[model samples]
Target: MSNALRVLMAQQNFLVGDIPGNTQKVIDGANQARMQQADVVMFPELALTGYPPEDLLLRPSLETRVGQALQRLCDEVRDIYLVVGYPRMRDGKLYNMAGVIHNGQLLGEYAKQCLPNYQVFDEKRYFSEGDQPLVVPINGVPVALTVCEDIWHPGPALQAREAGAQLMLNINASPFHIDKPRHRTELLRERARQAGCPILYVNMVGGQDELVFDGGSKVVDVAGELLFSGDHFQEADYLVEFDSASGRLSCAHPSEPHPTLEQSVYNALVLGVRDYVNKNGFKGVVLGLSGGIDSALTLAVAVDALGAERVEAVMMPFRYTSSMSLEDAEAEANTLGVQYDVISIEPMFDTFMGQLADQFEGTARDTTEENLQARCRGVLLMAISNKKGYLVLTTGNKSEMAVGYSTLYGDMAGGFDVLKDVPKTLVYRLSNYRNSISPVIPQRVIDRPPSAELAPDQTDQDSLPDYDVLDRILELYVECDYSADAIIAEGFDETDVKRVIWLVDINEYKRRQAPVGVRITQRGFGRDRRYPITSGWKAGV
Candidate 1:
């Protein structure tokens, strides 16, 4: 009977479907834990296949590759017990599983219970649930194991306690969303109390496509007090010493202070852009740099993620482009040390109008000219992307994308969108947050009214509701799924509510083709919320 046990939590980032590389990470983590004299090392969920492995799990050869990775893990891990997560194929069914290994021998295994199929998760599509609980022995101590979704519900946690386990280890690849950390902590505390034991939660960190997993891994006592937590949005290993006899565990170091909402959201955007560009083999990124808040914040995130050397800012000006816009655009690019380029769209706009003169003989000019200005810029950016091999990052926010305010193949044309799921209000907050770090964005830019600058003396408010008012309405309608009458009943103007809801409902076609972006809200466009393009449904009470 050992009185003290040490655990090394390997909070790591893994690329999806990289079995060989991910397997090597497990071996390396085990070696580090052994060298530090820790008794065991734990990894995040699906560490061997990265998170969500998505359709990669359906590959015919996936089983063979996973088996080899497991063998490699068992062979390389020597002194410390290695706890890792991987997708398993058993009895003609796929499962999300975790295993314990030591001295090239497989110990016990546990399959995930709950198969999440909501929001950003579709686990049921790839994994079958396990009904039995698994508790194993290590150094004369009873230890329980569970995968990502297993601890979300009470059954598995309570089952482990009833099965005579003194400690429980839960691994996860949970991605980031606003206030998700607090929600997870509450659930963990409740589970810990139910089990009457301390629990170790190892979570994945880093960006995958539009999703960013903030590690923030931690442990809690039976009383629901937090023992300690790893750094948010970082990958590192921390050692925890436990006394099985006393049922006490403590981390050697104090946990870092929790990040503010502004900081966390900003970090999520930076990580999302960085990994999407680097992992996909893009040389760098290029974006239109207007004097507006949206592009200003996007540039800051781009530079912080990929560095000034990899980001380029292009200001495509038109007749409506203000001198203030030009000055501020250049000033911000200079402040951030990013490469700046200026191209006038007057010629392109004129050429298109001239070419379409005969076809447009009967109609008067309206948004067609405004849209042409945007499309010209989009074409120029795409051409630059083709010649220079840099990905074009669009800068439309969720507020505009929610309605039919953005132009198709114009403002929405790009390889990726930085703020596709970010609300207009959050964009302002994040911009202020970035400036707080060092005041890079020009002060006047943040202070000025937001405008498309597509026409003379035009401002966003000319056609849309105030951002503060509009953003809240969007949350109620788009995020919370409140009907028009319900929102109107909440003391909002009926006209405004009806107009906003109409815009959102009628613009599904545009959103369907919009580029993917980071999802920071509980319900974001793309993966989190799905709506039909041709629905006959109306927004009513």
Candidate 2:
């Protein structure tokens, strides 16, 4: 029996639906691990097809491609045990499977037992759950295998321990949310303690549409103490040595300090934008720079994600545009070293208002004029995006999005929204966090009152509650699923709570049309929350 077992955890980023590419990555990763003297290497769940492949799993060629990929790994990889995740079909049913390949032979396979069906997961729609546990031997030490959601529950790990496993390896495609890293650590520790064995977890890193997987893979001792923690929001490989004789584990590196909440969220947004733009083949990104905190923060994020050369900021000024905004916009662009342009939207606004003069013969000036100004700016930005092959990044945050405070084809005109799921309060906090690294955003930008600048002397609070109060109410009502009365019972104003809920309920149509953004919360407005646009339900209950 071997005294020491070397395991390599491959935390990698994979493109969805790229079976052949992902296969080659697996082969390369396996060979690299073998060169590093690892006896076994483990990859993330569904690394062959990427996570949440959505409807792509239903393609007829999925099984064929997976079979060929497995064959290639078996042929090309040698002198090491490869535990990889892919989809398998048997008896007219599909399973989320992890297979062990060694020296051109398939040794064993484990199908995922727990299928997650809640927020951002629909595994039950695609896979039939496995009823049995899989325990394999590597280097004379028995090891149990489980998929992402399995470790969240206690049954699978306990089953593995009862099956004579000395160690456990769990592969995952877990997506990021605020404080999820800490939650994962606590969960793993409890699971390891319960199973009475050391557990090594490998998670994938990268952004998939609205989902950003932060790769903070971890290992915990049998006593529920952490041994090693991997990097977040990037791909890396680490080796861990397990002593079979004494049941001790040693890692090449120590756990990195966990990031602050703001840092984690900022990193997630940057990764989300970077992958979404690059993966979709955009040349760069362009956004309207209103000099408000929202656009200022968005610009900083874009520059951080794609660099100054790939990002462009345009200031579309109207009659009510402030001098302070103009100065701050240019200062911000210069500070970030991005291409800056100032285009006056007076002509476009005049043209539109003239065209609509006859139809508005009896109409009084209200939000219509304001919306027209926004539409002009939107049109200008969209034109630049079309000509430059840049993705338009909208700057509205969740507060404005919730209250229907934005125009349909106006501020919402973009292919991607940088702050779609972020609340107004958090936006300020992130801006401050970004500046703490270095002062790119001017202090005045952070200090000034936020405004749309569509009308004279307008500020956001003119029509909305204080951001602190509004954000709290939103957290309760939108994320916590608190009814209007329940929120009011939480000591919020009755009028404000009812009004906020009404706006959120009626704005489902707008949110449905809004561009997808990074989902940093468990209840972000994308896949996490699915409300009908035409529902007759009220928020009173």
Candidate 3:
């Protein structure tokens, strides 16, 4: 047996339901590892079937196809040890299993023990838990293997240590949230120190539906020291050498951290949008650039994600839109160098008001008139999407989406919403970051007051509280799941807390109809949050 062990980390993206394509990715990764003289190559959890296959696991034919794909991968990649994640049906139960393959033969398999059931994860619905931990000898070094959630608990690591394993390798398709990488590192270090073995954590990187997997995969020594860390929100294939004599593992180089939180969030959103579009077979994206903060940020993210060539931004202003807004929108469009269009909503707005004038009788011009303008823009954006085969990207933020501040099927008419999980405060931060990159968004766009521009002199503050104050209360009530009283006790005014909570509770119906967006926080307004839309409960502040 050699005194040195070389392993390759295959951090790549996989398209869900594309069996042949995913199998080819595994084969290619193995070939790359073998070229680097690596003895083993590890991939992310469920790499063969793609992460979060969701209900696709229920179909028998899908499982058969994945199994056949695995066999084909085994036959295609030779002389290199491969640890690939896939779903396996054994006996009468289904398991999230990792297969150890060498020389066209299956070495052994270990199923994931801990199945995460909370926060965008529902593995318990599709897979049964595995109790046994398996350690295999590769090049005379005992290597213990576990799936994604298994390492989160102490049981699997303890079992591996008791099995005389020298190193622990975990394959994961863990999704990303703000500060998730730091949390993962802290947990992995603790596990390594406890198990008294070097731990290698390999995570999947790419966008999967509402979830984004930032592959900051790393290795920690028995003393809980980081030996290597991979890049976040990008894909790479790299090799690490583990010294069997001293049980020390180190990568050739260290990965750099993202420049800033805004940079990290922006990159995540870009990757999320890029993979979502490509994986879903969409050629491009179309968005309504209302010359507002939300739409501006969405356009920046879209241009960065699919490239300016694949992004199309339209300015659909009504009679009430300020001239400054029109100028700012055009300047931002020109700066990003993407295709832009000016589709004035005056004709459509007049048509709608004419049709509803008789019905609206004495309801003197109020929110109904304001909403008509929004609906007109929505029709124009959707029309372009339908005609050009582009996916409409909605541009509402979480703060607005949470409180019914946005009109349903109006600005919310799109296939994807880029800022659905971002709050208004973060929107400002990301906009600033975008400008910092190259000053693509004009300074006036960032400095000017925020407004929907649905009516003359309309501003977000007119209907809602200040963004800074509102976002703080929202973070407490929504993200922290705090009660109205709890929020008020946290230094917020009682009326403000009650109003924010009430708005959140009453707006579930609108959120249900809003387009799906990237999930950057622990609780996005998607599947992670499910509330009764018809509830009559009120906050008792």
Per lDDT, the best of the predicted structures is 2
The CA lDDT at 422 in model 1 is 88
Q: Which RMSD does model 1 reach against the true structure?
A: 1.1
lDDT at 18 for candidate 3? Answer: 79
Q: Where is model 2 more than 4 Å wrong at Cα?
A: none
- Per-residue lDDT of 1-541 in model 1, one digit per residue for the tens? 5568798999998989889989988888888889899998999999999987899999999999999998888777898888999998889889899899988998988988898999999988888988888888877778899887887899998899999988899999999998888888888899899987889999999888778999999898878888887788888898988888888888976787668899999999998898889878899999999889999999999999999999999999998999999999999999999999999999888989999999999998799889989999999999999998999999999999998789999989898899988899888888899988999889899899999998899999999999988999999998898988889888888888889999999999999998888888889888888899989898986
Ranking by TM-score: 2, 1, 3
| Cα lDDT for residue 474, candidate 3 | 88
| Candidate 2 TM-score versus the reference | 0.99
Q: What value does the lDDT take at residue 262 in candidate 1? A: 93
> Which residue pairs clash in candidate 2?
none
The lDDT of model 3 is 0.87
Model 1 global lDDT (CA atoms, 0 to 1)? 0.90
List residue ranges in candidate 3 displaced over 4 A: none
- Clashes per candidate (backbone, < 3 Å): 0, 0, 0
- Which parts of model 1 are misplaced by more than 4 Å? none
* 196-218 per-residue lDDT for model 3 (tens digits): 79988889999988999999888
Sorted by lDDT, highest first, which candidate order results?
2, 1, 3
